[model samples]
Target: MCTETALRRENGDRFCLSTAQAETLLTGAPWRRFLVIGDEVADGRGEPAEGYGHDGWADRVAASLRRIQPGLAYLNLGRKGRLAAEIRSRQLGRVLEFKPDLTALTCCGAELVRDPFDADSVEAEFDRVVAPLRDSGGDVLLVNWFDITRFSPRSSEETERLRIRLRELAERKQAVALRHGAIYVNLAEHPAAADRDVFGADGSAPTMRGHAIAAASVIQGLGAHLTGAGDACR
Candidate 1:
């Protein structure tokens, strides 16, 4: 059921993960005091080309939650270009120190690129990163790496293999979380929140207004998960 859809690219390559999928991953979880950990996109730091600030999906999810309860606070631990192992090596230790109610780690693409031939390294690092969270009195939420390969045009065989590898990585991460009684959030399935024209003429950073909107989206979703609230402004 988790593998229900394929994310089709402009070049006819297909990957899978949908907004429905993302929502489903969070539906039955008992979440509160959310902490989002992932790459720049998860951190809401979009590149200058994306025409939007990077708040990416976290902002959207957080905003959705706040619409119903205006007083929810979420800690975002996203960094720029943080691969799984790197995140494991750097942030995981500090995150456990905070003892959050709920913590979500979104990762993938970088690991695939960094070690295209060694998938086990990513899995092992994920286990190491998340082990402490489970040991603590916290619900670890694993946010699956979103579809970034689609962003590029190099759809070679190697690229396809990388995509498959990331998918496997997502599954492994989810398993690790589940083994520790944690929730898993998958973002590969979210629809394109940005329109083709959401970018500026130069296509680098999002206009301030655009960043606010993007941040609002992440905040909405996170709020709902954290507070059992409803939708926020679009």
Candidate 2:
């Protein structure tokens, strides 16, 4: 069994879950095996960028879910600096092999920073990776890119353009997720995501604290979907 620790929210409220509550909440759910695929965020890239660490959001969520389902199997296939197309090409096949009951996809963050951004191509690749998982009867978590301008070191004009492109891509992704009944975790709309303190020195990968915020956001999105509170992201 896993333990719960206190995680602070943007409003300074603490989010904590008891073991019994976790078990109750996840009862009868089919999320025993969780798989994560995408870029640095899914890979658990921490500050200093030294190596993979257990401080990323995917790690945190896995730990929390273990309390509910002690037999939970979690696998993360996130690589630093991977574009959406690369994930679709390399990781999608491995993800299918895992046959995960729940999966989270967080790609395209690296692609948004590059020039000649092609929203159509990027989204199509994302769909290619996500559509199969959705069809497999597993719950998918689609995380949206936060507003890059908040931590971007680029010129104001460049950051603004990137932000616009990312937001557009996020919207399109959300639409697809909704169509497939996947839970969408909209970090762009989360208050904590805009806080520069939540990011690392590179202004891209998240710091330890930022990972906590992200994990909390994902859990909240899952709750919304499970409780029939409407679509997780709108």
Candidate 3:
């Protein structure tokens, strides 16, 4: 039972999951070729702090998968600041070429931060990237953006309104995940996302410690599908 047990603590905050624990949870996994595509977060932007997971979360996830399969090939096509259309255009073609058995897609940072949000356009971009991978007959994973605004308290009515929009965005992502039978990890609802320790110095991207938690969450999301004992993707 991979509890949200703290693997270690930094500044009194509990960081969950070590690479070894993730491996234990993912034991018996059969994926070989793995592709990660999306925005910067999917790219795993963050520095490695001592005692926390290093590199990007995707790499951490791959490292664990490697322990189990020992021959996993991982490729990350995520670029920071790439808009949804650009991600769909640039990264996805390479993904098809990789033909991975397992894949992860996350494109939230750009659109969620944009003003005058377009739900339909964002949804379209999501579908464009997600649909093709689904056609490839591989397992797909999706993650929602955490409520970034929580890091900075904004009392403005517009901020509250944007929160509503964020929830709607999560729903849209879930619909896509459900439609394709992909695993969706609802980072938006995870209480730890609101914690300050998980964020980077820039106040936006995840810290490597945050990466550990995210990797654990991915394993946790797969747990139900794999062993029927982890968090529900829906």
lDDT tens readout by residue for model 3, 1-234: 123334345334444664555666787898999898888888888756665535577887787788888989999998988888898888888889989888988876778668778888888888888788878888888877566666645567756776777888888988888777788888777878878867766656777777767777787776566875554443
- Say which candidate scores most in TM-score: 3
Query: So what's the TM-score on candidate 1?
Result: 0.61
lDDT, candidate 1, at 15: 22
Q: Model-by-model lDDT, in order?
A: 0.54, 0.74, 0.76
lDDT of 2 by residue, 174-198 (tens): 8778777788888888777767766
What stretches of model 3 exceed 4 Å from their correct place?
A: 1-15, 47-50, 153-155, 228-234
Off by over 4 Å in 2: 1-28, 48-54
Tens digit per residue, CA lDDT, model 1, 64-175: 4443335546778888778777787778766776667667677665666674456677778878876777677775656554454553355578668767876777678767
Looking at model 1, report the run of 10 residues with the lowest lDDT sum.
Answer: 7-16
Worst 10 residues of 2 by lDDT: 1-10
Q: Which should have the higher TM-score, number 1 or number 3?
A: 3
Highest lDDT scorer: 3
Question: Who is ahead in lDDT, 1 or 3?
Answer: 3
Question: What order do candidates take by lDDT, descending?
Answer: 3, 2, 1
TM-score of each: 0.61, 0.85, 0.87
Give candidate 1's root-mean-square deviation (CA, Å).
9.7
